[model samples]
Target: MARAGGKWRNAWRKSQKSNLKLRHTQFDAALHNWLLVEDRKQQRRQKYRSLPHSIIHSFSAISPRDVIVFCARKKHDDVAAMLFLQHGEVATYHVGWSSAHGRQTNAHYALLKHAADHFVRCGVTRLDLGTVDTENAPGLARFKIGSGARVRPLGGTWLRIPGL
Candidate 1:
């Protein structure tokens, strides 16, 4: 029920001053070396892939900071949520993970927002947010749509392995 409205904006402002800190890093960077490293490590991950990493790497030299991590610090920096994407002409959402505490604190929301802003600054004009299957994952569907993303049909070519 956390729509990107006035209430959410207020919470975002409050969270900035709160214990949670938003970070942007490269895809290859370590998750531990944040503000402070936390002990109790736990998370739930989700992955989506249209092409292999090798394919993406072929286009550009893989560098650091293509990732966004939302860290919540108490005694140490705890990774509340993290998101990774593949970039070309369009930046594609590759994968993401979030902890139970992250869900409670809406870490993914902040993470995605930060990432979108980062991508735009990097000259990326398009960001494909991957699939939104409401029949299976309704919450995820709503989340993506609620972020001002409209549904677009994906166009692609299917080919059989030549030898097969």
Candidate 2:
């Protein structure tokens, strides 16, 4: 059997070889046109929640360059990847939305490949792929897992009430 992290590393490496072009932009007011167009296109995506401009703006403001807006371009820009970075410590893979054509061409893999390199260059060692609904989103789980991230259950939510 292969080493544990080996497979994930391999997938990431494969993403690098793919010829998909990448553009990294700091999400800012200057991105008005991009934000509008991307939001509009992302809304029509099936089985995905539509992202709003306000939320995008808020995230961008909160993290600045940490909120990396990655777009994978082919002949045209076909897919976008949303990554939230905690500077050098960790970078979270928030979301990745792609058109049908983008998916058909496996643009995400290429995007991630570039992301891994970028993170390393920026001194980041961790990439959190967030939650995966195994039952409802097996494909996503497989994708993340196949990319080399280990799966663990998130800590449960708890509340402490005073004078209860």
Candidate 3:
């Protein structure tokens, strides 16, 4: 956190001011909450494209011991954000989502920082932050880079047929 720049520092401060709290929760509950919020927004004439139910079910079928889920909440216990990470020697961020109010308060920043801290404490050497496609998501790419992660490109893909 000390290495974070002014923007991230300000975001942390903003999250603090909002009285945001992070807690380890069941994945199903967090997903359910996000879906409910999306439903509410759609009813209010706001459009949202949600992930398919099958995806949620597939994720749920994974063993609980293999994944870690955290949910953020404000002072009034309103859901702020949720993060899902797969753990091993190197933890990998699987999914993350934040509410509208969360975006206003930079809840994602706080949640990510917290995740990093937690992984370090658990002796994880590295974290795979997924992709950073600057062309399509410059803001998201910048966010990942700002979090002190370096870009490591993958090598060329290889294909093999059973009987060539």
Give me the runs in candidate 3 sitting further than 4 Å from their true place: 29-62, 76-79, 156-161
Candidate 1 lDDT over 49-116, as tens digits, reads 33443432333344434443434433354546444554554677754555566666666667777777
Superposed by TM-score, candidate 1 places the C-alpha of residue 100 at a distance from the truth, in angstroms, of 1.3
Score every model by TM-score. Answer: 0.64, 0.71, 0.72
**lDDT per residue as tens, model 3, 91-145:** 7765566667878878878788777777788788888887887886687687787
- Model 1, which residues run further than 4 Å from truth? 1-18, 29-75, 160-164
Best by TM-score: 3
The 10-residue segment of model 2 with minimum total lDDT is 1-10
Question: Residue 23 in candidate 1 has what lDDT?
Answer: 69
Query: What tens-digit string does per-residue lDDT give for candidate 2 at 57-107?
Result: 676777677777677767665455554445558887755676665666666
User: What's the best-to-worst order under TM-score?
Assistant: 3, 2, 1
User: Whole-model lDDT, candidate 1?
Assistant: 0.56
Clashing pairs in 2: 8-148
Score candidate 3 by TM-score against the native: 0.72
Number of colliding residue pairs in each model: 5, 1, 0
